[model samples]
Target: MARFICGADRHQVTLLPNRLDDYVSEDNPVRVVDLFVDELDLTALGFASMMPAATGRPGYHPATLLKLYLYGYVNQVTSSRRLEREAGRNVELMWLTGRLAPDFKTIADFRRDNGPAIQAASRQFVVLCRQLGLLAGGVVALDGSRFKAVNTRDRNFTPAAVRRRIEQIEASIARYLAALDTADRQEDEVAHVRKVRIAERLDALRTRMRELQAMESLVEAAPDRQISLTDPDARAMATRGKGTGMVGYNVQAVVDTEHHLIVAHEVTNVGHDRTQLAHMSRQGQVATGHEALSVLADRGYFSGEEIL
Candidate 1:
């Protein structure tokens, strides 16, 4: 007792390993995790390559990556980098993936390579809801929301705004040219005349005009004139219930009348809901296999043609 040892020879550490299996059993927050895994056709879901027959080392299974993604989405952790961290630290994620932590690149690649599959998986959830009698084909609600874009304010331009800018620039160029001509006539020897500055401004304006023209050309070439730096597919649309509205895309979904389960969804650049009724109705019809369906939309979706 008098001679105290500084460190134990074995240096036994009592760190508790994450027991993911036990947590995934009955009464867990994600009880359906097992059911979902068991019912899913992982091979057909485009994750066949995730489980490779490698020699000694185990490869990252696609299920692991998918589960991570699903969990991340459920918790609003959509970033790949954040998901990577969760895999390493979060107990639930550790259990979900069986303690296998895939790198961010791997997680990102899974998402990129399986975008269609992921979308299909979401649809499968809707199909499941339908099967469970959660969705009894009935009246559906329609709504949309706008999300901010990554493009800078200066880079974005409406057709009318662009035309106005071009006109102003042209006017400025004309005035500059007139000033230059007057300066030449008045006397080339006018010592302090800022002809070069005016000419330079005119040249810059011309350059901007060319850039604007190029952007216009791009817009013409695009299927949709709208572009977003962050999500290239995202569009600028208006909000519903209209206080002021936002600059983002209209995300429409068909919710079942009985349990309000979403049967179908679409994203559109069109701001107004007036034009959405027919398109959403058609989509709902296709999703539900119904010839005629009742649609209950907010006043925003009300239109003469829609009623017709």
Candidate 2:
């Protein structure tokens, strides 16, 4: 309580409460999110649950959820759990959602069940950006990023990884069999317990080997010579770090250089950016509504087939 420009007392109550609108300025981006989503027709955009069913309880309005979704996307708060947390405490979100905080499950379910509608909305946003002269430049840059999937490293298998794992298991089984033989020669209860443990380990290893054998057939049959058990669409992609990789999809984006707004995007299981030149260029042309769009990318995107 030192008198260095003291703040209001913790327990002090004011007769006139501050409004949420007072905290947000006129040019704040949340207003744009509200306006943009308000102008959309949810039913025409393919959003589900636009009309409430007669038998169920009322849910959050599609416009409210859409505003929340757009705010999260524009600010890079894409995780449903994080969005849920922000809705409770963040002033901008409080204003955007009208103080309604949907749970993480509701937010996640909305995203999961509305993929097509989300895509449709995104396309419309790009159109708006173009009409607003935000996408004035005919030049765009192309890039790709690998987004990690739910699949873990151990559950993902390449043909080479499968071979290496089988070899390691074979080695482990040999070592276990030698130890079991040594245990059999011992004339004590401790040795008997050791043999039983060794037997169990061998059984587990054999079972794992059999599972890998079945997986090997699938891996070989795959066009990419790899298989991800948890997320089948994910593929192993090499990152910039040497000998480092992740199981995920490659997201390609064509972004306008002037405003840095993404004009077009596509997600694929392909790992590299080499063959994406022509396709992304065409997409950029379509999105910007310009026939002579120039595309720029790094050396990794250089491919004779794609350029030709």
Candidate 3:
């Protein structure tokens, strides 16, 4: 038996109550989130239910949910389910929300219903940074990256993809039909089974072909000649790697060069950065509260129309 340092007894009780604040420090980032949300005029910012309803059961205060969201975002816990779990276990979150744990649906509903208000809150942070001189520089850098959406490649369709799929299906059907023809010329039990299997495959292929034809019509009628079954706004965007692409959204961001702070950002379905330079540059200028600003971007954003 090895002797170890003695530990406190689990049954031991303390005469003094331990305050939740004792677990959090004055400089903790969660404190910043709490203070920021507390100071915001949520009603003016368009957050729903700033006050409890005049009648009926009251809901969780928007401030409480906002604090939880901010804390979760800062900690990279974006999933509502994960946030709910954290609220139950995280000490900082316990203090932030006064130990009131809302379910995942409530958390998700807040985000879904308050998208514009949430965007306003994000802009408010940039405004605060500008007020603090973090965005003093008039120079900014613009860049865009493809973020994979929840949509899978199979769920997305383009005119070219539809054509390729049709061609492949047609080739498969032809091969099965030729095999069936060969089976018809044979005189054996195995030949009959082979013929049946080949016929089944051909039938399945025909059904698939009909589905593809319907999808082709939809793709052709689409404004961008593409459709994503999962995320309608998602698009097929090319990656940096050659011959690689993903079904996703393009996120463009303009950052102040001085403090490396994001001044403006946009989520777009358009896959390329060529047309985003001017728009992002103007947004950066507005975010920094500057009359004029200089913008720098990679060659990918070099477009004659955008520059002129």
Per-residue lDDT tens digits for candidate 1, residues 142-192, read 676555555443455555546777888889889988987776666555522
Which runs of model 3 end up more than 4 angstroms from their true locations? 1-17, 51-57, 186-194
The lDDT values for all models are: 0.73, 0.92, 0.92
lDDT of 3: 0.92
- Clashes counted in candidate 3 amount to 0
lDDT of 1: 0.73
Candidate 1: regions farther than 4 A off: 1-18, 22-25, 47-59, 137-139, 167-202, 217-234, 238-247, 257-260, 285-293
Model 2: per-residue Cα lDDT over 1-308, one tens digit each: 57678878889987764788887889999999989898988899999888898887789987888888889998999999999999999999999888999999999999999999989999999999999999989999999988999998888999988999999999999999999999999999999999999999999999999999999999999887988989999999888798688889999999999999999999999999898899989999999999888898999899999999
TM-score of 2: 0.96
- Give the TM-scores of the predictions, in the order they appear: 0.70, 0.96, 0.89
Per-candidate count of clashing residue pairs (backbone under 3 Å): 1, 0, 0
Q: What's the CA error at residue 34 for candidate 2, in Å? A: 0.2
- Score residue 102 of candidate 3 by CA lDDT: 98
